[model samples]
Target: MGEKQPNERLTSWFVRSGWSKGELARQVNRRARQTGAHHVSTDTSRVRRWLDGEQPREPIPKILSELFSERFGSVVTVEDLGLRAVVPVTGAGEVDLPWSGAQTVQLISEYSRSDLMLNRRGFLGTSLALTAGSALIEPMQRWLAPGPSGTPTPILTAANGGEPHTGRLSGPELALLEQTTVMFRQWDAHNGGGLRRKAVVGQLHEVTDLLQETYPQETTRRLFRLTAELAHLAGWMSYDVGMHPSAQKYYVLALHAAKEAGDRPFGALILSDMSRQMIHLNRGEDALELIHLAQYGSRDTASPRTAALLYSMEARAYANLGEVNKCHRAARLAEDTFSDVRTGETEPDWITFFSEAELNAENAHSYRDLAYHSSRSPLYASMAAPVMERAVDLFRVDETHRRSYAFNLIGMASVHLLQEEPEAAAGLAHQAVDIAGKVRSERLNTRIRKTTDAALRRYPSVAEVQHLSDRITTALPEYAAAG
Candidate 1:
């Protein structure tokens, strides 16, 4: 609004890197595309604007820090470049956790409150960069350490000087809360997170408040596990709507809650979820590290289905890295382990969702990535097609999972596209578009647009491709407008 000042800190770093303004812009754009942020298109003009002390939105500053760090062969941060003003943490919740049992209560309370306020203000954790994949290693090591048993701590009140045990709930109340959690999970699976992420955040806020009251040891453990599940749900919802930094923070809180509850298997699952996000962002090496950590940590405790899920994620990471043989090996391990699962074996509800449908979906995803990475695209695409078809068939029968059904259709279209079947690809893409209208998911919308765009690019002269492009333009008007 006023006369702007030059960003001397950024300029100094830019000069030290010895890259021209155009080069910097080009590199930043390349990195953004590599992460699947397809809408980002940094030009020299934008770089010049940044030099004039204008802040770029969301992930640009984060990308610049990583690029600078690489060029200098040392760590460079947003703070060192005076971009901290743009990347605000907004609350005390982000302070590195001490991992003590009581800190879980404090962290959830503070973090959820901040999250709700941000939602009210129409801001959804857009100021922070995604945490580096390697950055999580030390924190994970701390998670594996045998620490305190996570007993509850008292919260002092000024009004009641001696009273410390007033905040307890009856068993029915806890049961109702757990039931609400399951309902939320089902709702998310069907409709995506855009519709109810705020509701989940509010519930998490209430749960953290309940944790402040002292309870018996067993009750405390149950409350903490609920906290973990809610936090994980909150994170998943945020990711569904593309609020990535917020999702990452929520996931960290969830992992902390799981640790306090002494739920090691669920903790491993949280790590796997984080790895999935990393893979979505195209950080394959970082994703590989996280999946490995999950597998190692859950070795003695994980159920067969959980192990199968972890192996599938490992295959995805390897596929992303173009390691076809390793991907196959992990995929086979996942299949073998899953085939051995006996009926009626006790398993957690969180894991029961990873049935044949989800497994095939994951397998299809791995081969799709391999198709993208391989020089022999048709070879891998052929492998992906039938698996993806089965995944789509399985998903279609489950009414609670329409969003996943739409996602698999897009994958099937991708496989067809790679095999030079534009007409078939267009048909599947049309079904995905129809489902996208019913699903309120930012990620799904983006994927549909991306897949359709690819189809248009590949077969621009084909009538079916033209029709698909026209359909997408009508259905996803915002993407059309952006173009």
Candidate 2:
């Protein structure tokens, strides 16, 4: 008992590294064999002893040191392993600076991993406090203010009145805009929408500055439209990042820009997005109102697909409100409008993804909503499976959408739990949680928590279910307080 052992330190390190005890043991055994320690085996007791700060015999200790060094790319010795200590270093001097393209990629990869950890549920108890209304006020005010050339004018004309501008932007500028959109969209799908908010918002600010500084009236107007779209996306990212108020502000500013541009269809899209966010926040009534407003606003100008999307969104809101009849009517209307969408039809840019299959998925969601409010949810639960399965399949092609697909699985699991299928529900719930761990999305975590909570209530006798519930409870904020 010369020096007390630090058993907890080893456990903490293993957890931080995302490794299980078995995994650590396997690595140790592999390293031991490589180091010619034929007698050394990472059995359960030996692993436990090491976790308890008991250094292994000579050769095994060296092997452990080499293993950790290779794994983390840092020097580790028997003393470091036994003491379970880390010497903190300061600033840029502590870490290697990546230089080459490959090194840069590796650095970015590491940063992405750290960012995911930051976004994880219950990883740290700290919360990110951000408000869109406050953060965006200055920028919105600046945009609204009269410039040197007077009030910034819109380029595109209303579908019903005045001539619409068909002027094409410079090739380079348009390409850059498109490229930025693609990159952000890709990042949004792969890393969860929240992770890219800062970068996207920064890009939007830069685009806005560039337009204000250099572009003529007409060009600036078009550029403003692009900026507005980016702003809406940025707001969406904010919402995903748990900054709901900030998201609302971005939506409002985006709506304003769309109106100023006279882009009725685009404006409707922004409103629909706002409604979607409201729904997530449990403001179903507000969401319904916004969706209705979007519908009315786009009626004169929206393409068939755009109209269908608005109708689909309205259906979603109605479903959330437990308005079965209205949800059905809206879903049908969406399908009907979608049927009229023809090949080669010049659809609004925003509604390009609203295909027939996607419309069916919306219908399925509407039914699922009906199930949520009805006592016999199991009857309708099966209907959601095929539709959501298709949606998940489509979503898996892009990494950014994996979290979304995982969320959908959580929703589907809720349906299973409603149907009294605890096993299937647990399986899906576990998958959702695992995927949630990989992304930096508060929204996905929220969804997982909701699903887990519901499952616990439905199947209280299941140990795994209870464990999952406990995990979520420990990870999230104080539920009652947050509510």
- Encode model 2's per-residue lDDT on 1-483: one tens digit a residue: 587565543454455556667777788787667657677678777777778767556556545555554454333333334342221212222122322222322333333233235433211101222222223223323322333355333322221235443344576877688578767876776667645665776576556544433334456556657766776787677667555544665666566556455577887888888778767756677678777777776788888898998999998898898887888789889878888888997754446656654676676777777788777677667766677667656655644457667766777677677678877888878778777666667677767766776887778999878877766544432221121
The best candidate in terms of TM-score: 1
TM-score of 2: 0.62
For every model in order, what is the number of clashing pairs? 0, 6
Q: What is the C-alpha RMSD of each candidate to the true structure, in Å?
A: 10.8, 14.9
* lDDT against the true structure, each candidate: 0.79, 0.61
lDDT minimum window of 10 residues, candidate 1: 151-160
Q: How does each model score on TM-score?
A: 0.78, 0.62
Q: What ranges in model 1 sit over 4 Å off? A: 1-96, 148-165, 477-483
